[model samples]
Structures are given as structure tokens and as C-alpha cells.
Target: MSPRPDTAARQQPSPSSPPSDRVRRFTRAERWVHRTTAALMGVCVATAACLYLPEFAELVGRRDLVVRLHEWAGLLLPLPLLAGLASRALRADLGRLNRFGPHDGTWLREALRGRRGPAGKFNAGQKIYASWLAGATLVMLGTGLVMWFTHLTPLMWRTSATFVHDWLALTLGVVLAGHIGMALRDPESRTGLRTGTVDRAWAEREHELWRP
Candidate 1:
């Protein structure tokens, strides 16, 4: 007599089945917004460098063109994020970024010791970075607008705005460089952003609280 058919089916894995090792991490819309924001921010940062660095300014020439490009790029920096709010998942995730659980503090403590604890989709460090970037972008936008409309403002105010804008841009550039460096060093994290899926084992090890 043949072994039970149901038992046989349960024993054999399907050859054409999708890989079970991968789990969806980011939605397509999330990835789209992330890429768009990064591209726009990159343009803003590059133009800023060209405008500020004497060597780059001389090499690039067309100071006025670079200034205009930088201003426009800065103004557009928040658009991708605003558009992403249309996605329910993105909206929900934004809320998640705002809330800090006991586990988050634990994660930070572990981080200080060169270790990490089980964290949710966004770790404590990432949440802090996202929050900081959101505020920084708004501040940049406000100062940028004031500088762009310098003719409408008092000369002193315009000068102040320019000072604030320049310093903020420099700080943001440094922070963004660190962000890029960390992303480059973590292939699994990078893969999640690019492919919207992370290896199940990788996710479990890095973000134990996250469930597929």
C-alpha cells in the first residue's frame, strides 16, 4: 500500500515555490519616496558644496546657476515625504517613529555597549535620525525661503538667515555622510531599502521584534 498522499505532499517542498528566506520590509511606495527624497537631497547638497567651497565654486563657475539650483532643490526636498503620506503604511510608520517604547531605551543602552537588543522595524537610532532630519529640513526650508526672498526682508534679517542656512546645511551634510557610511556598511539594511525585502534570518537577528 502507498504511503498516505497527504503525508507525501507534506514531506516534499515545492521546487517552484518562492524563497521563504525573504520577508517584505518596505512597501513599493516607501522605497519610491526614499529614493526620490535621497536624489533631491543629493542635488541640494552637491549644489550647496559648489556654492560654498572656493575651489569647487571656481571649478564649477556659474555661481548664480548653482545658487538657484540649490534653492529649488532645498524647497523640493520635502515634497517626496509629503507625497509619501498618501500611503497608509507610510503614514502608520511615521506614527511608529514618534513613539518610544521601553525596548527603545533598552536598545540604546545596548548600543552604547557595542551591542544591540531586539528592536522593531525602526531601531531607536533610526527613529532619532528620522525625527532630527524632519525638523532640520523644515528649518532649512524656512531659512532658505528667507534667504531667497532677501529683498523683502531687512538686511540684518537676511544676513541672519544666511548664517543660519549655511551652518545648518553644513551640519546636515556631515550627518548625511554618516548615514550613508552606515548604510554602506550594512548590506542587509541597504537591501531592504533597494529591494523592499530583507532576508528572514537577517531581520530576525537585527530586528527581533519585527514580524513578517
Candidate 2:
């Protein structure tokens, strides 16, 4: 028979452990960059919708006003994104998001089944959205420049730019809504993004695979 459990083992208290504290994840500069980009994107989307939707445009009229707002927003959009890209930590995080690994495939499978799997720092869906946003932003910037500086492109090219710009804006707006919804689904996640630090339990539960 197995040895009887020791009364001393049960009676003696376990070794004292230090209390866990939440650590700062994103630096102030990094959080600033994220906030700046999000704000600019929000304004750009709102104004673009006003310009595109006939009912909405009628209320906000003057195509020139919407066009000017979009141009300025386009100019400001790259600043924060570029700053984030320059940071070593942010760049590394972006690289991790770009990578498609076996774990990502497993996560995707579980996601399709309406089940949650162990997610790393960013899951496959988030990675795809990030990539799409980065690409779409670049495309929008280039196209916007062509439209803003009409002298740079022929009339046909300008017309094409209009089509491309409008469609991409609508698509990105939809994608951004989904991304924001996912982030807001978990209160901890929204708090983390807003405050740049999350509870240790939240980190371990949602991003255990993220090793710094």
C-alpha cells in the first residue's frame, strides 16, 4: 500500500511566494502611436462615408471638403504607422503576426468549429487583419496622392484612382469594425490595448505563447 500522506506535509504551510504584479507591456510612445493611428483612421472613415453615401453627402455636401479631409487624413495616417514600425518591439510583433505556423493552422481549425484555442500574442485572424490593414493603407495613400495631385495622373488614371480609393476605404472600414469588435469581446483585451498593461491572468490565459 502507498505510504500514508504525511501530516506534517499537510500541516506545514507552502513556501511564501511573491505577489504577482502586472507589468507594462506597451511603452507610452507605442501606445501613443496606436492611438494616433486609430484616431486618424476613424476620422478618415467617417468623412469618406459622408462623401460617398448620397444621403450622407447631401447633409455634408461640398465634395471638396470631404476630399480635403481625406487628403489630410491620408497624410497623417502614415506617421503613426511608420513610428510603430520603427520600434523594435512593434516591428518584431508585426513579424510574428505575419508568420503562418502549424499552431496558427490549428487555431484556425478550432476557430471554424466555434471553439477557442490557445492563442499566441496575435491569432491568425488578427494577423490577417493586420496585414490587410497595412497593405490597404499603403494602397490608399498612393491612390489618394494621385487623386489629390491630379496633374500627376491622366484623366483615366484619376478616374481609376477614385474607384480604387472608394472601394478600398469601404472594405477597410468593414474589416476595421470586425477587428474592433473582436478586441472588445474580451474586456481584458480592450483594457490592455487602452492602458498598455493587462492582468497577469489575462495575459497567461490569452497570450501564454507570447514569449518576450
Candidate 3:
């Protein structure tokens, strides 16, 4: 016997699957800013190598072009972050980077003891990296400008800027190497950067305090 229309409709099995258990980790604009910043930094590093290292200089050739590229890339390094301010997500994350909680201190101690601790969106290490890099980049920009525009500063000031710029570039290279190594070791972090989302389970596990 056929049931009434309302009864049949109620008895029909659900068709769609459950929603995905993923949380947004990075917004599209945030990812774009990161990618653009990395690319410009890479250009600066590569061109710096060409200008400073004899082997790379010989291999690449065209001294004038390399210098121009390096200078322009360095000059444009901050544009991506400035443009990304249009994104609310990016603005919120920047605030997270600036704040250090009591939990961050606990997280660091537990990390030293080979244990995991609850962490918010930006952990202690990440916060330190972000803050340090921001200051370093500004210093680099200031020193680089002085070096480029010879008439902008006195001879003594230019010499000091050159000294600081060279050493800072080398230090930045080492820090970047460590950062890349750590990122490569964590596939989940790479996935977050790539897809702008992370598994809810992974977030709850790794960032117990940050499950959204």
C-alpha cells in the first residue's frame, strides 16, 4: 500500500554526505601574501649571490641586470604585506603574531622537555620568527637604501650600512634555511599553507588551544 506523500517524504533516506571536518587555517589573501613575499625574498637572495659570489656572478653574467633586479626586488618586498591588509583574516593573524600569552611560555618549556603543550594559532616560535623577521626586513631595507643611494648618506654612514647589510644578509640566509627545514619536516604545516585549511582532528591534536 502507498503511504501518504508527507509520510514518504519523511521516510526517504538522506542523500548528501556530512560536511567536511576541516577548519580554515589561512585565507586566500594570506596565502597570496606569503607566496609573494617568499618569491621576492628568493629573488633578492639569488641576485645578492650573483652580485657578491664570484662563481654565481660568472655563471649568471650581466652584472648591471643582476644589480637592478636585486635592488628592485628588495624595494618591493613590503608591498605584498601592505596589500594584504585589505584582508580581515590577515589583519587578525598579524595581531596574533604580536601577542604573547602565558600559554606560549608553557608551550616552550614543554617543548624543551620533549612534550607537547596547548598552543594557539601562532605558537611561541612562530611569534618570535614573525617579529624578528619584520624588524630584520626593515633594517635590511634601510641599510640597502643607504647602500644604493650613495649620496643619501655620508661616506662613514654608507660604510657602516654596507657592513650591517652584508652580515644581516648572511644571518637571514641561515635563519631562512632553518625555517624551511622545519617546514619541510612537517607535512601538515605545508598542507595548511597550500590548501588554506587543516584537518579539525589535526588542529585539535597539535594546537589543542586553537581548535576553531
Query: What is the lDDT for 16 in model 2?
Result: 45
Candidate 2's C-alpha runs over 4 A off are: 1-23
Residues 1-212 of candidate 2 have per-residue lDDT tens digits of 65557965776555542125564556656788888999999889888888878998998888887878877988899898687776887877767878888888888898899986667888888888878888999999989888889997899999999899988988898888888887778887777677777777777766677653
lDDT, residue 169, candidate 2: 85
Off by over 4 Å in 1: 1-18
Measured over all alpha carbons after superposition, the RMSD of each candidate to the real structure, in angstroms, is: 3.5, 8.0, 4.2
Query: What's each prediction's clash count?
Result: 0, 0, 0
What range of 10 consecutive residues in model 1 has the weakest lDDT sum? 10-19
CA lDDT, every model vs. true structure: 0.90, 0.80, 0.91
**Prediction 1 TM-score vs. true:** 0.90
Worst 10 residues of 2 by lDDT: 14-23
Model 2 residue-pair collision total: 0
Task: Give the alpha carbon lDDT tens digit for every residue of 1-113 in model 3.
Answer: 98999999887754442227777799889999999999999999999989899999999999999999999999999999999999999999999899999999998999899
Clashing pairs in 1: none
